[model samples]
Target: MRTPAQNAHLALLLEVAGTPKPGNVDRHRDLEDLRFEHFLAGAVGAQRGLEQAANGGAVGPAFERSVEGMAAQGGGNTQFGALLLLVPLVRAAADDLSQPVVEAICEDTTVADAAGFYRAFDHVDVFVGEPPAEMEPLDVRRGSDAVPALEERGLTLLDIMEQSVPGDDVAREWVRGFERSFVAAERLAEADGPLTERAAAVFLSLLAERPDTLVATRSGEAVAQEVTERAAELVERNALETDRKIVERFADELVERGVNPGTTADITAAGLFIALERGAITV
Candidate 1:
């Protein structure tokens, strides 16, 4: 069996190598300073922390450590979203990929995990929305300063996620039994091609399914909705690839428009991780 770190690292590579991921960087695409190499290095750099998570380490600190590894390697937070999904999945797979095992890990999250998550933000830039109105001064964007409030309420990471599910795609995955990740894995299985192409297709499918919360948080709901509609149109007419130029043009437009469907990419990475862990794909 491959180590959890290896699986996660490979999963990130596969997710990044998959080309034409709408609004996101891939092998054939670049985003200013965030190139494909940064992501590749970030994944490999994060392996040790992922191994710790698999070995029953705290998810939050492990996540923090992983993001720190990325920064240490000159990678600017390229794989934070991927790490967030993979750490728990890797930890759960240490027992089995069964839903109960994974759900238990999520439910067992502590305030420290929440703090670790916030600390990760201090190391990298991820556009996030405001904190819950009831939880003043607990903004994730506040970085470590919000930790005291997080601790004062003694809210577990899962508790924090539950509150954000309405607007956070990743949080929805955690609170809802990872429905999207697993479904994307199934979609990956049904699509036959190089593992990279399958991963890319799964990403497009996810973009068709919902507006990316990250995009909505960064841009606005209107832009995200427009992206969703475009993806849906491509998927509905089976024209995502029939006319390669059009698809490429759309990707170029999204990049120019600064609309990143990041949540979809994150979930796509999660799906790739699950597929590997389940032996549906080999490293």
Candidate 2:
């Protein structure tokens, strides 16, 4: 039998799978859409708890520690288990919702499977330009590697939100609206050109609070700038090399603790490699 937490997560997933999609809905269609929406809302609420845990909140420390311990184990680890658990949740949500929008999210997840999570950082490096000439080469490379790892980790965490919460229709509709808004804003930013520094800063400020905004915004330049600034800040405030090593060590420790880490490490490593090969560090 699934534990109470797992049961709760499954319940939330069911809710999101049932919500209504925007624009394409016909009132003539049955109340099944509405019921789905209701379930989706509840699932989203439950997912917040899961996200917090995945992101290193107090509630998820044990799980995080377990992941770390699994990483220590030579081949398998906690991250792999997390992925296995996560894949089913997302897949179920997609299957239940049967909407284009939900399918899009599933598509994105599928792409993630192909590309791995860390690939997004390549866009970030391109946005930020090159580090100062005086900065150590090792530091730059390590920093570059670290950014993608964190991004991949974040995506892994988002899997909980995407899969566990439920309401495919509602979530997809919300995603559509968000995309529309982001596209509009990006257009405005692009037209402004180099004058967009302030706009870029504002965008990043908003992104810090709402990362999802990037999906909707059309201005790759603006998004890139925001990512660059954020990455720089992380480098200045923390040692990228040290942080990367620590994360690796944590995974190692998790393995020693008897948790499976193979999936996370494979995904993370793949992402890092992709970023390194495809990413641009200089503007």
Candidate whose lDDT is highest: 1
The clash tally of candidate 1 reads: 0
Could you tell me the TM-score of candidate 1? Answer: 0.95
Residue 98's lDDT within candidate 1 is 67
CA error at residue 33 for candidate 2, angstroms: 48
In model 1, state the lDDT of residue 231.
88
Among all windows of 10 consecutive residues in model 1, the one with the lowest summed lDDT is: 70-79
> On a 0 to 100 scale, what is the lDDT of residue 193 in model 2?
26
Model 1 residue 107 CA deviation in Å: 0.6
Candidate 2 residue spans exceeding 4 A from truth: 1-5, 8-76, 79-102, 108-283
Q: What does the lDDT come to for candidate 2?
A: 0.29
RMSD of 1: 1.5
Which is the leading candidate under TM-score? 1
lDDT of 2 at 214: 20
Q: For each candidate in the order shown, give its overall lDDT on alpha carbons.
A: 0.84, 0.29
